[model samples]
Target: MDTTTYPAPQHRTATTTAPPPRGPAATFALHLGAMAVAMLLGMLLLAPVATALADAAGWDQAAAGPEAEALVMAATMTLGMAVWMVHRGHGPRAVGEMTAAMVLPFAMGLAPYWAGLVSAADALVVGHVLMLPAMVGAMLLRRSEYTGGHAHIRARTAWGRAVEAVAHRWPTLLALGLTFDSWLRPGIPPAWTLLLLGAEYLVIGAVRREFHRDRLLAAHIAGFVLYLGLAAVAATTPATVAGPVIAAAWILHIAWDAALHRADRVTWRWYAEACAVIDLVVGVTVLLAL
Candidate 1:
């Protein structure tokens, strides 16, 4: 993911910037238990809808079944995880863990369904349905961060608010523009999509120049180079290869966006969330189209 204000890559402990600790064991248990329940629910609900969509779209089960199933699994997981991250106070530490959950069903469970060895219901149920409780819990915890809610999670700081504000503005529209292009055109190469992301970085960097000069430049420079390199890589890679790369880059982009805002390097914090969502939708669209 291209980022204008990326964090210096570093190790972050699980408790680093999270709201008041529930203790390592307790925190882990909370997400695990809640996610399990949520997954169960989401599976029951999404499975039927997915089947209907697949039928209506005239999906070739034997041919594009894996891709379709994977798409469904990944989209649901991404949405659930992103929602969880937001409600969870947009905590940096929890983002990776939650994001990781998005892949479990796509990589493992969906394969069995493609092979006719498992039902879509079973696969999706095991994939991200549990994300419902996870998001609900996180949202409730972070509610205090906003209006009426619990007191465990702290409200965002002044810098955090600013970063959110900035991110919610143009960056979001930028993602939407890219997404619309991808949807409408359907054949724009990954290189072009990524190059646009580089352009976005330039715009963000330019915006940040008005503030702290030193901290923003190095990251922006690195991000520009990285995005271009990725574009080159995507240009040569097959869709099978490029799809994952693009999806991963988008996920990483979402994470870095959060990290930046959390570090107060951003003025508004909404861009990361928007980017994550659009990336998820766009990434799946590309995967399926391919």
Candidate 2:
């Protein structure tokens, strides 16, 4: 009886409103800041843990060189966590997710090394394996959040837009191709491969209007000089040049990423492209050298 008096049940349209899309710059800033902070935290926490573990295991920190390796691994893992955290949105949940992702690798790698159950090299490999799970887990847990975001315009400038487009499309294709070529050929030195990989990022940064030209130029110069120095060292010793080169490259990559994130011109897509190119170059170079 009351329904007869109700004003036609006041029909309300079900509105499917989309969440506000984050611009490339905002995304870049969020990720970059998180990564930088994560690395800093890793430096504080991981360095000491690695040193203590090395000492307890009776591993010669100098010969085994676990410290630098640990730091690098920790930093990389932290960066990964930072990316996941940003995707998940800022909160305790993000922190928990990052911690879990980071801890898995540390436990798999450093724990074994600390226990003297595995050689440093074996531990490193195992640690890397653990990272796959951690990365996948973190991403899967936050998949809904990442997928829910709106698609926004990438960059305003023509060059910036072009760089973003190519980066999103091809990211690591060149590096992957070169790596395959080197594997098939078997004569190409790894250093040459890595150099090419680094060069790809340099070119990407150079071509992109979104990047800070001065910073990119500086990064290119630094990477080149460091690579050359390592090459010269390898010539005399012929020992594993990877240790030094990788260290330098990682530091350079992190620094460049941090600096680019700070600059107003750069976008998230640009940073992602830089990283993809850097990873490809580094992976190819290492494979070729080996």
**lDDT of model 1 at residue 189?**
43
Clashes of each: 18, 5
Question: How big is the positional error of residue 138 in model 2, measured in Å on the Cα after superposition?
Answer: 2.6
Q: How accurate locally is residue 112 in candidate 2, as Cα lDDT from 0 to 100?
A: 72
lDDT of 1 by residue, 98-207 (tens): 55545553566666776888886677665455444544455445443323222323325876555334433534534553465455445434566876665575576577
When summed lDDT is taken over every stretch of 10 residues in candidate 2, the lowest stretch is: 170-179
- How many residue-pair clashes does candidate 1 contain? 18
Question: Alpha carbon lDDT of residue 142, candidate 1?
Answer: 42
Look at candidate 2 and tell me the lDDT of residue 141.
71
lDDT of 1: 0.55
**lDDT tens readout by residue for model 2, 1-290:** 56566456754343223453676446544544554455554454445455556667897666646645765566645643443343333344545675667656866687878898888788778866776566556645765433345233334577645544443443243234323333334332444444553455466665665346475577576776666665555445544554446434533555555454466233354455446555545545454555
- TM-score of model 2 (CA atoms): 0.32
